[model samples]
Target: MDAYDLHSGNGNNLSGYANAQIDGIISALAVSADPAERARLLAEAAPVLWDEMPTLPLYRQQRTLLMSTKMYAVSRNPTRWGAGWNMDRWALAR
Candidate 1:
């Protein structure tokens, strides 16, 4: 589970949920019209926000499993653009 601490200015009272950091981040991001400002707020709040009391972080989980027989090459890097991406290929034994 992912979580973040909350601050009074971040607004954790309205939701009534014990953990509402994701809401706070969305609210902060929504309040800003500028892309740079939105990014700035996200970066600033990431360290101190979560689902307890004041801050909350949205939880994201990535899962993967692989099976192969003759495959000899595969890439699992998330940043790769083409076949090197997580979906590209899988290593297998011949």
Candidate 2:
């Protein structure tokens, strides 16, 4: 949200995107502690963000993981962590 906020500083908001409604939602989300309320806030914010389109994704990485069907316990770790991050827990069906 900082990236799209009106008063974001420290180079956090490069796009210079600003919207009052989103700003209020971002402020509320920042101090919110309740998980349900946070989720509700995010739910309320997503469509507004989409409609506003502060920034557009220019490219998307295409990832592929090939494994035998018997493979189990494979975890979808972040790209920086790599897919084998949880290799110890991986197993194969008999």
Candidate 3:
């Protein structure tokens, strides 16, 4: 398991142990049916999880743009999965 851990860690050099910890947490959450239990585990593990310094936040993206005037409407539903789905609906600018 240590070898796997080392390889996985190296493969995800940007996130360090974050990926592993998230995987573990997800797996634990999946197996746990109770919301309270899942919340408890997340609360207990969150601080310790960051102790490994698996990931670092370099900068934050304050704003983003699509850059289109032709399109009559372009909006994303946060509940939806992917962002790029309606490129065909965009119209050319006159």
Candidate 4:
């Protein structure tokens, strides 16, 4: 599929073109009931854009937060938000 990212305005995350090419295979994998068939189609579609991605992985940064004895509801992997983004569940130890 040919991916395009117009919103980023810098052209980073678009895969529409590549997506178009393998859309059938993706759709088949989605609706396929048989596990073997699903695996087969997934295997068939995974390599369509091998070594062709615009962006490459570099490194993973570890996030660490030291909270006091009262903090809670912290997410393990807060990709879209901060570690303590969900503060509704926070409580203090009496």
Highest TM-score, which number?
Answer: 2
Candidate 2 local lDDT, 1-94, one digit each (tens): 3333343432566787777777777788778899999899889888987998877878766656778899999867654446888899999999
Rank ordering of all candidates by TM-score, starting from the highest: 2, 4, 3, 1
Cα lDDT for residue 35, model 3? 88
Clashes of each: 10, 0, 2, 13
Q: So what's the TM-score on candidate 2?
A: 0.51
Off by over 4 Å in 1: 1-26, 50-94
TM-scores, one per candidate: 0.28, 0.51, 0.38, 0.44
Candidate 4 structure lDDT: 0.55
lDDT of 3 by residue, 1-59 (tens): 12123224346343354455556665676589898998986786677656765445576
Enumerate residue pairs that collide in model 2.
none
lDDT of 4 by residue, 1-94 (tens): 1222311232544532445545577556557799999888767755764644434447656678777766555545435345666666767676
Candidate 4: which stretches are off by over 4 Å?
Answer: 1-18, 21-46
The true-versus-predicted C-alpha distance at residue 42 of model 4, in Å, is 7.5
Error of 4 at 73 (Å): 2.6
